[model samples]
Target: MHGALPATLILLAAAVLAVVACRQLKLPALLGYLIVGIVIGPNALALLPNSEDTSYLAEFGIVFLMFSIGLEFSLPKLKALRHSVFGLGAGQVLATIALTLPLAWFGHLPWAASVALGGALAMSSTAIVSTLLNERVELNTPHGQQIIGVLLFQDLAVVPLLILIPALANPAGGVIEALGWATFKAIIVLTILLYYGQKLMRPWFHMVAKQRSKELFIINLLLVTLGIAYLTSLAGLSLALGAFLAGMLISETEYRYQVEDDIRPFQDVLLGLFFVTVGMRLNFATLEQQWPLLLLFLVLLIPLKALLIFGLSRLMRSPSSVAWRTALSLAQAGEFGFVLIALAHGHQLLPPNLEQALLGAILLSMLVAPFLMQKRDALVRRFVASEWLNESLNLTQIAVQSMLARNHVILCGYGRSGQNLARLLEREEIHFFALDLDPERVREAAAAGDSVVFGDAGKREVLMAAGLSRAQAVVVTFSDTHMALRILSHVQALKPGLPVIVRTFDETDVDKLKEAGAVEVVAEVMEGSLMLASHVLMLLGTPLNRVLQHIRSVREERYDLFRGFFRGATDDSDDPSEQDQPRLHSVLITEEAASVGKSLGELRVAELVEIKAIKRRNIKGVEPSDEVVVNVGDVLVLLGRPARLAKAEARLLEG
Candidate 1:
């Protein structure tokens, strides 16, 4: 409507059009926003006459974005990832600086400029990587975790680097003096914000928010954001970084989720504008002139950075695939790179030409990153099938061999039960691998070093992962009889000689499982009945020992009948006297087992059975040497040669 009104309206129109078009193309809305900025940029269609104002607005967007990051930051969350966030993060910063400083100097920049360039180039874009990963729902993946950790560390570097650039221009004092002063001021500001902001900021927000008006809250959010930004600037740190710190402080409060949700719209709009402004900074003339150099740099930059970050991830002992994904996710420069470069230029620490060149590289890299991430799994598969990823196979195999190798246990399902089982296994010193259908579960478990993942015990491919070929014992927690049969069939195919303990909720699958080579088919209903029977007996005034004996008899009788008839039904009737048949010794009574009311020495059953391990529902660990005494409900890991084991098991069944 005014001087720049028509042009401004046109740019807004282009921004909307770009968003709609990008949605159609299935690209990020931010990419479309950038397209709008580039199309209307001074160097291009020139639809927008006010380029400088656009840049300022874009700068505000970064402030808002950083503030959002701060609000989300919690001391506990950071503490949880401290090893990666601080240790790995700091290492990446130093290593990147060390690696790139020489390269920048070789490019003919002055030492100070070289240092600035090195710092700027070493940083990768967290915003871009996060957006893509979230879109793919892979943020929960191992690589995703590592990527988030490293990016946080990279963001942590931005504040100091920004301060350093401006301080580098001040020749009156040495670097150490400037550094000390900067550090002191930052500490003061941080301490003041945490100590004072917590008391005042929340109340201030409540007072402002009570107006129950959106505009009031928006104004408050802005004030909190820019107010901190302004304060941080006066304290010799970047306003964006300061705002981030303030947001983090407020994030810990009850109002944080509301604050984040409330300000999210503004953050998105501003952040989008910021990316567009960045895109507008891409000078096509230079890209055309130096496309070759830019391409070479892009190729070299991504691989080199990826290699460094990957090595850092491995140094953190992050799983191998996770390390690669993190490296790839962060191989390109991030939004903070823009912030740092802008600060450097503002301080005259970096020249305009370098900014333009690096900006072009970064923008191009960002545009390609999502595609790369989407294709990551495909790439990993190819490499993993080859010798390339072979050398870096995650602990899946190692875990299988270590704790899982012997008669340990094979968890047939990686659901809630399986997860708990593994935790219990750790304490009991029982080696086990969790088998499941979910890839993310496997990845997450692997990252936690549980080495339990990525297999459906139902599938041969999955069994191979669980090392079913070597596993001494197996536990199928999944209760679906049909699925159990399918899994049992597959497992038996792989290891016909291996003992398989199949879990089922129905009796229909018992004969099928035995025929398929399962050593035992455990029906949930049968176990429950015996447990209920024993509990009822003890509750009915039967002595605990008599109750224990009764339950033991029941399990032995049921198993003997099942094992006998199961084999007979399968045409392998070796034992016809189902009652006289030797007890299945594989079933041992723990201190808590129904037999727990009895003692090994009291039962004189040390000669009767072997103890596998003891599991207490209350505790996750095993005693390796569980005490001879019985406890209430203690799961006895028992092994008897056969007849004694079955008889010992029969003791549980006695009425």
Candidate 2:
């Protein structure tokens, strides 16, 4: 017990010092904690007496880390990026494994070891990348989103790889039967966890959460994380895998955020311990003796992996400027390499020297990760300037559409929402460039001859590349409020007084976004108000002239209204445009019985509206031309003066 006290004290002290150092240096605390472990480890100070205990804690940390990742790794996010995460992710892993296996075999490793090394090396550090992105405030950036999507797919990849490992371990046995048994156990465990664990965990968490005791909350967190982790491992899987499952289960509950908050302190501490243990486990003696082998591996293996990533990214046709940097950033070995190598050693699947080589290779790669990420730009520049790296960089720059003019529009995000807005802008002859993160969408738009910029709006560099520095007005059509605010702030900082319109999925985010400098906020809930204000005034028997006047003024004054909505007591900046006289535009679609079969051109809507399109319910397709007919299920979308739109509704709809 007395020996335990010194160990505990020393560990705590190391944690404190490392945390402080990390904070001071603005680096990730996890890296600092790892350094702490390396310093006090047996190779260094030798303060820790029990290596086995550290291993157990490290195992627990693995469970908790995966669980936390699962909690944040939402089903909703997956659904949103399913095509990329699953499609690209699966392709990358398979291609890497297939290509590397023969090379490994040629290197004199057994086929199983070759495949195991391939699987281990193919998986990147989701945890490390996630933390790094958060630390760098890049989570919502296009590159950040892509990295995350790819990592999630990588995590999902672990499922198949897990099943494959044991089969490879027992090649003589009937592989199909072993796979079936393994799958059956996995399903039973998953079903029981889904059916029962969820049922019990939430109410139990609620009760614990209601206690309002921080100590109890921390204990509950560890219990849930460790308990499920233990249960899952008992069913024949990595504790890390179980932790992820447990997190997903808990994520379904309302208490998830609370659980996350409560787990923070424990996560921080245990995560530090985990990294430290990882560092301590590093066999530095061998590294010091065979520095040449270490250098050779770093020089040979790192570049090979990086080149593979670059080629894959190019084959996928990621952004011209971004692809190389992305490959360089993620090309290094991740935490899974350690797990796979250790597992192989435990199972006697690999020789000790080989395992040592892999471990040394992995640690060295991790040490290089921060440098690679930090110097990404310089590396990119160097890669572009280098004759060796110039092949990939010499590819075409992103095909961009021009949005040049005073009052030129800038549409950020080319998702479904942006697409709809672009259609409207097109009909209006509004010259605007649509910025989208998806390379495919950008390609699609380019092929279609639409003006689009394939870049992230969150980055000042990307935005500058998109001509946002000269944009007359910027419109954010994506749903991420944090990202929207960041764009808004940057736009305002770059060109003060630029009118920026932002879209919000809910009214809840309106005040926050507006306060962040959005000139106008369009919450989807208020969409009906555009139609509602017209009818309500007509029903009230207000003069049509007055009604039209009110609606147009609202449309024009909305920007000013939002601009001044949050001024504090001492703030004297009132938007002057809100005080302007009302102006109205009326659109009335006349529905004549005879005009129903005719398109807008035949109806000569130009006599009523310069622009209008039919809005179809639950569908996305263009309205037919004058030569084509309008059927019963269409609604005319006419743009004109308030009175004109109201007056021509019948003519527009019928046409």
Candidate 3:
């Protein structure tokens, strides 16, 4: 027991360091876990023993992983993606297996072992592909949808494969009888659990939830998951199958999201341990001697798999670019491949040397996956002439639309917030051009006569074609900080002085965006809170004028741009003289201007215009004191009536 504790600590410490390094390197955490296992396992440093107890604990990871997959399983989702999921996805899995089976058989492997190897080789990394796609904001793209659908089908395939692989290990040469009996058992157990379990699940959860004790709810959740798993094991099936059944039953209930939230920590930690155990099984000596075999397997895994998927995608009538991208994104072997390989090894269907080689190839393929996905666009553009043509046509369309547009706003996204801003701009008769990535949204909006185009605003050429040089301002309506920073970089390089207003989820990224040259950062959370507070105050009978003043003060404190608004034809009032009310304007102190070295007090324009703020390079919206000296290239933000503002600017520029 004492030795076990130290070994556990060592394992945990190694895992922590590996995961931290992976995070800093922007790689997947699962890869880190695998590396940790390889470095510390019996065949390497031997910090921990390759014991049955550890393997038994790791099996729970598979159970939880299957549970999570079942939680995400929905009949409607599968039906919606039926073509991609069943057609392309099914074809990919079956074809890869069919190709592998013959090769394994020719390599002198038994039929059972060949099938197991084929099943393991057929899987691709869902975790890596999904994360990269999400970070690139491509999850809604056509190829992205197809990639997800294929992954979904692969996840579903694991359940039956788990049952089949074990049955294939039967020594009695009655492989067909064993398979039939296993399938029958799975059907009967699933029917009983799913049909009868569904009826009991909701009411049982309701009763538990009514207890209103979180501890009780959690305890009951574990009981349900593990209890079903035990039942399935007793029925001579894998525990993972039962856990999957448990998750599927819970998915149909109102508590699905809560259950998923509750299960994630368990799923993630256990899944990491599972991958570590798989890594521990690797033999470095075997890898060193069989380098050629490893290379051969890597080729079969990545390029060959990619070719198969690409061909299948073309058969499905996908465009060449879309098919290539989908293929590249899903080319690497997945975590499930490890699970099946480990299971096969346990069943004595796979030899140790072959397993090590397969593991090495899968690991290497995963390491190469991120780079492949990142370079997919470049590759597609180089190889697929149609991709370049499509991009050229898109840019041409954008340029033609904006050729006659001057002083127009460039909207970076056309989602809900962008649409609202567009409507307000239209009401005020302001010219605006919108760029959106969603093809359907762009088509529908353009069909309704909206000035929008299908293009990525982050691209330099796209922004140029959208009239960035002639734009009055740019508004980034999407709340992606990374993409917003990229757009800010392009804007600063192309047109330094044009104001770019960015929207974010909260104040967490306000300073970051501002430092990147955004003139204003609007936080939706802050706006929502202000609206909530204002409504509450009004409901409490606070005077309207007082409430408005409070809201304005909050805005002024939070946003530099809210200090004043530029006067326009839209600023109407009962009296015509109100049009001359104090408004904001910016004056640039050029090197040749009279105000180049003047102090704020010596400006001699206080009565004409108030100095609201001074914006210098790398600093924005700094309040100017009377004794503050002005320098060349400074931007003076002034507030006064239009005629007074004109005089103030002339005095500052020409003395």
Candidate 4:
């Protein structure tokens, strides 16, 4: 018990210290976890003596990680990026395998072992790439989307690879027959899960939801995840595969977000444990003895993988910069390489020395991952400036169309909602341009002489191509919250005073959209509820005028009653624009402003009108900081008559 206490202390202490060090250095915490494992591992300080326990935790880590990955696996998203997913993704995997196999064979590995090694090394770490991309706020970028598409295919390929590995291990007993049986079993299990499992899961989730017990929901989630994994194990497939399938099944239901929110804390901790286990398995003695060999492998392997992925991206007609960034981002050997090597070693497929060497090589690649990704922007611009220009040629259609329209409304997402809006605008003799991703929708709309272009609205170039500068207003008609938020940012940045109307399915995003610069957010859920309440009031002997007044009151308060019932005071903020009569205005002080270092009292805006609260970026808001010196990023909230407020706003802006 005393020994166990010390081991626990060592593990916790090392992890904390390493994580702090990495955070201070602006590196991912994953590297810190790996370092912690190495320090406590048997090959180093030997604080942890039992590798078996770590291995068990590591397996569960992979399961939860895959489950999280599966949540993002929507059919619509796949269909939207079919070209990249199928063409570039498939090409990257097969090409890397083909490239790596010959090298492995040249190193005197058996044919079966060579193929397994190639496949293992070909995969980049989804856990690492995704975490970094999200943190850097690049997940929605074109290259970022391509990287995810390729990673999705890589994750799906793991199921077949899991089966293939076992067959490779038993080649003497008719590998083809073993693989066939395993494949057949996999198909049957998947079919059962798809056909019946989805139906059962929806009701199970509904039942859990009805109970309204958070504990029961969590317990049920664990049971479903583990049960599916156990079933897959019995059918001779990996537990991670089953867990991923379970996530996919849950994703089709409404309860997936709740499930994800609940599982995240567990997944993160276990994933750290898994990386620690990988670190523990690293033999530093071998690395120290063959430092040059490790360096050689890193230099050769990372570039090879990057070149292969880059070539594939180029083949798919991606811009050189985007292709280069994607290539560099995924140039590392993945976590699965460790799992595959461990499994191969267990099956007596790899010699101890070879396993250690491969481990050293993989760890080296992972160590360089942060550097490669961090410098991705600089690297792309430095090398691919010429290709960037060539890619701009494809925007010719957008340019020509945009030049034809001036003072036209730019409508994003030309779906049903957008089409309806267009019809009304057409009847009013209003000129408008629409941008949509669906080729069929764009074509159909164009045939009817509607001004529509095939492009992503979130892209700045696309928005510019839609003549954003010449637009009277912009309307976003999509239910995608992130994309809508991004589009709102672009619109606000380009034209701060432009009236933007955004449509959403529910009231959950009303405030966020408003803050993001949407002049009006039309939430269908809130509107429907209002209509229902009006009808009920009229039927219950209430006056029609009174019912209408109540609804009007609710809108005047910005649906405050609903917000108070659901969201609470956390959403509260004093916006001067919401005031009656002359609207309130907030102006941000910039660095070059003449009043950058001046206090509110010095600005003397108080004489003209009331100075409301001042909010500093990355700091708490203060109530009328009269004596407080104004910083570059400080937001000054002012309310006055329109004429006086306009002068005050100009003073702040000029300053």
Candidate 5:
């Protein structure tokens, strides 16, 4: 027991270090887990023994993974993507297997082994591909949709394959008869569970939820998931199949998301262990002896798979660029491929040398997957001529829309907030051009007489085509801080003085955006909270004028731009008496300036312009005192009327 404790600690420590390293290196945690297993397994350093107990525990990882997949198995989603899921996705999987079966059979593998190998090879890394697509904001693109559809079908295909593989392993009764009986049992079990399980799952979950104890809810969730799994195992089916059924049943209920959230931690840890066990199975001796075979397998896996997918996508009428992207995105072997390989090895369908070779090839392919996806755009552009023409035409459309407008606002997003702002602008007779990425949204909006274009505002060329030089201001209505920073950088490069307003979800990024040169950042959460508070105060009998003043004071305190409005040509419409309203100006204390080394009191421009702040080296000191000394590189933030501000700048530079 004591020895076991140390081994467990070693495993935990290694897993943590691997995950941290993977995160820092921007690689998948799955790779890290596999590497940890290889380094510490009995085949290598042997820090941990290859024990049945560890392998048994790791099996639950597969169970939870299937459960998660089951939760995502929505009827409506499949229906919506039926063409891609069933047509392209099924074609990819079936074609991959059909091609592999002949090759494996030619290599003298038995029929069952060939089928198993083929099933394993048919999968692409869902974790890696989906994450990269989301990060690149391409999940809604034509190829992204097709990629997701294919992945979904692959996940669903694993269920039947799981049942079939074990049946093939034991053909004592005869291969056909064994498969027939296994299929019968699976159908019967699935029917009973699906037919009755749905009826009981919702009410059962409701009962648990009514208990309102989070601990009890989690306990009940595990019970249902594992109980169903155990029942399936009792009926001679895989535990993963039962878990998948359990997830599908619960997915029809309101508790599906809750169940998913509760099950993720368990799934992640166990899944990592599962990958580790897979890595341990990889014999370094076998790999050393079979390096050429591993290399051959790697070559066959990536390019052949890519070509196959590319051909399939083109056959389905996808553009060359879209087909290339989809092919590159899914060319790598998937995590489920490892699962299938492990399953096949467990069933003794694959030899040790062969299993090791396949594992090595799959791992190497996954490592190369990210690089391939990163270069997808470049590769597509280089290979596909239409891509360049498409982009140029898109830019032309944007330029045509903005050519007639002068001193108009440029909205970086045309979502709900952007639409609302456009309405407000329109009521005031202001011209604005909105940019959005969703083609559907752009089409509908343009049809509705909106001055919107389909374009990625983060792209420098897009902003240039949107007439950034002629625009009075730019407003980023989307709450993506990274994209906002990118736009800010472009705006700063093109026109540094342009006032760009950014919208964020919360104050967490307000300072960051401000430092990135945004004239102002409006936080949705802050504004929502202020509105909520104002409503509550009014309901509690606070006077309307008092509440309004309180809100104004809060805004003035929080937002520097709210303290005074910058004068524009439109300001002439305001009251004549307000023409001298105090405005803000910045004065840079250069080496040639007289105020370079002088204290605030020495400048004596306070009567004309209030020294609001001192900004030096990206740091701002609000309401700087008279005793504060001004340095050569300091920027004095002054507040005064237009006339006073000009006079104060001259006084500071020439005194």
Candidate 6:
């Protein structure tokens, strides 16, 4: 207990100072944490000598980090990004290994050691990459998604490689036979999880959430995360694997988002410790003795790994800028390399000098990563400017020359929904131009005499080329919510009063889209549910006109009928032009108003007009219920004809 106390205090002090220094410098806090680890580590000041104890506790950092990542990636989301997660991710890992194997062999390492080193070098730092991307608010960008996909695969690949490395040292059994047995064990564990894990998780969380206790919720989160991690460790996989599976199970439950928010503070703190532990393992003495050799190796390794990633990304059809960013962002050796190299040394697969050299290279590379990422955008613009400009110009020329039209509808995608929308517009003799990323689709559409261009709709040049400045309306029909939101922001900034229509898959994004100046957001799930309800009512012998009227009433209520599915949904009728209102007035409650301190029910608002919604500072509000109290500075939405609204506004002022 005495020993533990000082270790904890030292870590806390170091972490605090590091965070402050990094903050003051306007650098990422991760670099500060790592520098603290290196400065006070056993090799330096030796403030904490118990490396074993710190290492054990620090391992939880990766576990919780992997769990949070799994929470963000639900099954549906993974399916949506399968092209990156599986295709590009798998290709990058294999390609890295293939490229590194020859170099490892030429260094005079044995064949088994070469394979082990190749696997070790194939990984990129998820902890650093994820933190940097989150800090930069670029995790949703195309290259950011690519990095995430490859990092996920690298994490998964560690489990098998960890087992295989030790097996290669003493091949009493055939190497293939040992690998097959390990693979079978892993499959069994995963199969068991796939079949029954989510079922058990949902009910467990439901009961916990019923209690509505924050303490209990946090306790349950730790129990489930650590417990699952222990189980996977028992099955011979990495602890991170179990935590990831636990997160995936919880992801299927309604409480996933809440759990994520609750666990993030813990994950961030623990991950800081993990990086510190990693830095502590780097011995400055070994690095000093081998500085020249290590420096040469580091120089060679970074560029080669980056080149491999770039080539593989291009093969996956990523744009040149995106591919370059992804490559540079992941050009360093990963945290997992330390674990692999340690395992390799334990199995006698690597010599002491070689191990030291590899460690020095990896630590230096990680130290350099933050700076590279900070300059990533500038580097891309500087190096890839010519090629990117040529591509942009070619696409813009094609779009304007072949498809541009005055007062035409500008479509932001040419997917299934986009094509359908274009056909309807064509039937009405309305001209349209489309921007899509799928080159094959663009070629086919152009050959069919339809106006379509190959380009990302989120680009300013692409929008301008599609005649966004002159277009009568802009409609975004893609389901990529980030891209759709980007296009919406761009168009709104260019033309604030333009009628922007957005199509989304569900209510998850309806309010956000509407707030971003979308004139209307068509939610597929809500519309489908409405259609099904109408059919059921008709089958029950309700008159067609009555059924249609009921549907219209439900929709007119802003789908309040479906609020049970999506809680805390606000009234969207605040926009005047979107509604069939003669006038929609936004009246601010004044301090002198008689109603300022009164309950909404006392205002006799029902007799005057409807209280559509209310906005307050720092709160997500919907339509005000009758029990709400009127406050000064509250913005109230009063909906009625022009004259009635005028009287209501006067009364509000008087109140």
How do the candidates rank by lDDT, highest first? 3, 5, 4, 6, 1, 2
Of 2 and 4, the candidate ahead on lDDT is 4
Report the C-alpha lDDT of model 6 over 56-171, residue by residue, as the tens digit.
77778878877886786666766766888788778877777676667555777677788788888888888779877865546656787888888877876776776688667766
Q: What TM-score would every model get versus the actual structure?
A: 0.60, 0.59, 0.90, 0.67, 0.88, 0.59
> Which candidate leads in lDDT?
3
Put down candidate 3 lDDT per residue, 42-112, tens digits, no spaces: 99999988899889999999999999898999999999899999999999988987887786657888778
Error of 2 at 378 (Å): 4.9
lDDT of 1 by residue, 1-655 (tens): 4987897688678888988997776566877877777787766887765467777887788787778778767778788778878877788878877876776557776566766777877787676677677655455555666677778878767767866777766664476688778878878988998898888887887788788998887777777778889989887687787778878878876778778888888888888878777666667886777777677667877888888988888888977666777777788876677777777776776666667777777777877877788677666556445424443353345444444365457787776767876787677576776665567677787787875655445545656655666676667776665566667667555654345677777687787666555667778788888888888888889999888777767777766434232111122244555445533333424443555555555655556665544544422144434245565544444553445656666664341
Q: How many clashes (backbone N, Cα, C below 3 Å) per candidate?
A: 40, 26, 0, 2, 0, 2
Worst 10 residues of 2 by lDDT: 562-571
| Decoy 1 TM-score against native | 0.60
Candidate 2 lDDT over residue span 221-294, tens digit each: 77878788778778876677778887888898897887888777666666667778766765677667767766
How far in Å is the alpha carbon of 621 misplaced in model 6? 33
- CA shift at 528, candidate 5, in angstroms? 3.9
Candidate 4: regions farther than 4 A off: 9-29, 66-87, 130-146, 170-221, 231-238, 241-266, 312-326, 367-386, 390-580, 585-604, 612-624, 628-637, 646-655
Q: Please report how far candidate 4 places residue 608 from its true position, in Å.
A: 2.0
Better of 2 and 6 by lDDT: 6
lDDT of each: 0.68, 0.67, 0.89, 0.79, 0.88, 0.76
Q: Which stretches of candidate 3 lie over 4 Å from their true place?
A: 1-6, 539-546, 566-655
